[model samples]
Target: MAKYLPPLFTRLYLSLLTAIFASILLTFYLSEQFLQRSDVVDFYEDSLQVFIDVSSYLQRNGQTAEQLFKDDTVLDPEFEILWQKNWDANADCEHCKFLSVIANTAIYQLSDEQLLAVYPLQQSEEVILISDKPANSSIFSGDRRQQNSSLITLFRNDPSEFIPYLLLLIVIISLGTTLYFSVRRLQKQINQLVKVNQEFGRGELSARAQKNYTEPVNELAQSFNRMADAITETVSENQIFAQAVPHEMRTPLSRIQLATGLLRQRKLKCEELVLLDNIDDYIDDIEKLTRQVLTFSKLNSISNQCDHQAKQCIKLDDFLQGRIKRLVVDNNLSINLNLQALQLECDPAYLRLIFDNLIKNALQYAATHIEVNLKVSPKNLIMLTVDDDGPGIDNLQFETIFQPFSRLDKSRNQETGGLGLGLPIAKAATRRINGHLFVSHSHLGGARFSCQLPLKVP
Candidate 1:
């Protein structure tokens, strides 16, 4: 599951999750601390203001503080006064501590049972307002004390707080979800374009991307389609030229061969006989080049047109045995075969292009020994390898070696280095049959040409 998702997707998933939850938690905490209902705020502020006003009034009027039952003159007061006492000014309470002092009013450290406040009057007396906490109060403090202390309780008492919190949460979640799905859709479209490109690479020149995509992707598809169009036009014209020239030259080539054969039968000097032999060799090389180009042209134009039955399974071991025996008899080279009995679905043309060139090269370059291995892989692939103890190729030349007319062996006389289309033909035909061919350092102290083909054709 971890490997299936792209690295960008995994990183975005974690980052978005952390951002959403962390933003929500930070917003909720800030709202609980600073943004709150008006009445809840007024409760604590009014306590200090009311006490200060009364204390000033008592000093001006020469009267004592009002008692709850005895103060019938006061009506609808904000605080239900439980008790008031004359305390020593500038003296701390024995059991409780001073929380803060504002405008000569000292806020006491409240107890769970009572709300306590102290104020100094005339620098001689401390008037303390103490009341038993009401069970059915309008608010509950965060500290569980009887005083109103927190804004979180606003959610239970007011819809305004909860509504904003819920809306913020919903908006955060919705944005993250939208971004996630947007990227996922983009990745899906990119994957589809990649698949189309693979099909075109496999010789399905008609494969193209559809226009049902979002921007950037749509523009990229258009660019690829334009490039494919130009390449297809160029390749079609070149294929026609390649096929026509070789075919038209065949008539002249045949005439030359026939004239040389007749001239050899007649009485001629020794130099004239050598010239005829040279003409025969030149005709053969041209014929070989024409055949190579024609074979490659046919393979290059493959468009998946083979019928289902054309891809037939054959006994691979038997197929190689016959071909290897014939090649050995013709070349007179000592070659070893390690074959496994396996069935593989293959096109005969592609098989010919692959083994004919591979075995031929081994015979040409090998000093004295050659080996071939044919076996089934654990991945259900048919593996074929040909090894030779010749001057092995350098690693730097591996890529260029598969290109047409590429000969790494520079000092070849007429007997060696046949037209250098063999490796390119083998490589192209490997693609035609949906296989991979690669070169490795051989165990026999030379070059190894390995081909891996799927057991079932796609």
Candidate 2:
């Protein structure tokens, strides 16, 4: 669970829980106060009932004592005297008293017992006082004291009065502090990680993040590291191989090249010269092989070099005719050209290589005709198609035909001479120039290889 949640989310969850705990505490405090004060409300009601009983007793009529009470002579001829005598007796009788007094002598004067207050009501001129005197004559001071002290005790202990609000304030402050610190810590780690990433991107390969990555980023970094390590190791191995391979092949190739040159210059008899010609042919094949190996090595070293080189716009119809003319003169091969005067933007050397491989493949298998076609579209695309009347490839082998060292022809004889990297190298060169190459069935009942090149305007 801890790992599933980010630290920020975890902190937020804790903050919410803290807030809930505080709220619950505050609610409990209020509820407890309400329960405590319930008894005080009942005490107030009892005081009201005692006052009603005293009022009823004062209204009673009797003999001389009643007449004297009515005349206010024996009652000290003042309402205060009557009220005090009865109020004090009731306080003592009931043994509970909860009252206070506030008086003004200019108005009705107060006696010994503390007068709570006398305030005029809004609609009437009559003033009423709720004093620290018992309402009933029968209730004693001891009885009143019990109820009075209980009310004061309840007010003191009731949590609803202030504690709930105090607790809420503390909880808000604490949660805010916790959130602030957690955000600051997370921000610091994130900023540090970003800085490290920027340094690494700028070729500081040794740089690393302080905090562990958030899953996706970690996996991405791991993949990049793996790829970088593989490239580094492979480059080191290639450098070693490049140094050794040329030295090993150089001795044999130098001898073959020397023998071919000598044979070309010497004069001899017919049969003897024929033997020399055969030797010369074998030497030429060796030279070609050596050259192919060197070219392959260079291609491997810089696969994208073609894209960086300058390009020229060449006419397809004129170019094909020239190429076919050259091939017929050099290799004694017959050719037929079928193309439009379409212009293409490409590196001439690479484009020549593409057509050379396709034409050579055709010449090897073609019975009579090697058909070439060039198509153009308004969308800046040029398609070159080469077809031959030869044994076609199976659909299952189509994808494998483009692999290096892959050849459908089983025989490895001089008659069908090739290093098998021709087509693959052509494909790589085409890709470097952002071209597409694919093979399909031809009209001549053989394989048709088509290459599409984007013809951008100079």
Candidate 3:
């Protein structure tokens, strides 16, 4: 079953809407309760005044309670009078009391859903007064009583009675719509920030979040941009340092090579010649190290600018054959190639750099033979592999070897004249063209450098 998860803004909107609706409902309920209580208190005061008026009328006329009751049955317009002589005969009325206490006036509900107020006459003989319409309808059934009461019957029967509820509905809809758009705007900004952060994490150091000062999220965007700036500056400085150190060392290396060549030309003993050969080997190692460092730094710089770099559709087969032929002449190494006539869209300089590093690394380590294979997949992906017949790399070193300045062993470094930057430069060059480079155990009992690149330019 798929979990029902909502987005952050959606959850926030729902929670806010629910809180608002509940608050409005609670306010309405409490206000209705307060108004009902106020109405009840006013009705009690009016009823007490009416009772006092009846008592005053009997005293002003110089008449007794029994004579006043018999003469005038109706006392006020708001209430009716009922003379009950044998009230004890009714079992329900046995517990009923005279008007000696203010609580004696009680509300009586009839069988036909009508409300009646029953009050004692406060006389010698037992008598009660009743009212068909209570002093306040709210005293009985709260606001619901006003719905059926005669006072609001005309309003309820009219069509316009729905106006208040209709207005309330419109207000709720307007609030919801406003919240929706506001949340959507916030979500869009947040998504943009997230996308930029993801791209930055993926090594696009130039990626930055767009800022809008009018928005609240602009503060976050500002912080993100600052962080990106710091990281990009740091990486650029490091690349500059890497390139600078190599360029400074190259001059001394060239002088050392000249001195060693001149020394080797002198007539010397066998042991002395061997010492000169060792010096020559050491010079070659230093030269190789300088070249690798320069290439590594250049690849790092180019990868950062790959987006604006020009790319060309180059024939892969012809390109590999020319590069292999040149390497063969330089290193006197036997290399086999199985390349297809496929066109690839990439920076030709970077592509040649990638192949040169891989093929040179293979030739350096291979005992007898090296193989280069290039093919296009069904998905239009270019796959290139370079394998050798030397001892394969340890599985653990597959990733370690691609790190700059990483070496498997000191002996291998000395024998191969490598400063462990060939594979790293190759990897960087592959990435410049939106490609991946990885190494695995080759079928020929050696390391296999595999590269996958998209045929279509990105």
lDDT of 2 by residue, 161-187 (tens): 565557767776787677767656655
- lDDT tens digits, residues 350-451, model 1? 887799889988888888899999998888888999999989989998888888778876532336766888899998889887899989889888899999
Question: lDDT score of model 3?
Answer: 0.73
lDDT of 3 by residue, 1-458 (tens): 23687877888999988877777677767876696555444555665576677768867988755677777566887655455554442454432222222376654433122333455665454545443444454223344333455636755666475565666677678898999898888888999899999888767787888867346799999999999999889888988898889789878877987887787788878998888788778777877777778877877762455555667889999999988878764445567788887898778888988999898788777888888999986777899999998888998788888898787665535555467777788898888777999999898888898999987867
Q: How high a TM-score does candidate 1 get?
A: 0.77
What TM-score would every model get versus the actual structure? 0.77, 0.48, 0.64
- Per-residue error for 323 in candidate 2, Å, reads 1.5
> RMSD to native for every prediction?
5.6, 16.3, 7.8
Model 2 vs. true fold: TM: 0.48
Predicted structure 3, TM vs. truth: 0.64
Q: Evaluate candidate 2 by giving its C-alpha RMSD to the native, one decimal.
A: 16.3
lDDT for position 138 in model 1: 19
Angstrom error at residue 82, model 2: 48
Choose the strongest candidate by lDDT.
1
Q: Ranking under lDDT, best-scoring first?
A: 1, 3, 2
lDDT of 1: 0.74
Cα miss at 438, model 1 (Å)? 1.1
| Structure candidate 1, residue pairs in collision | none
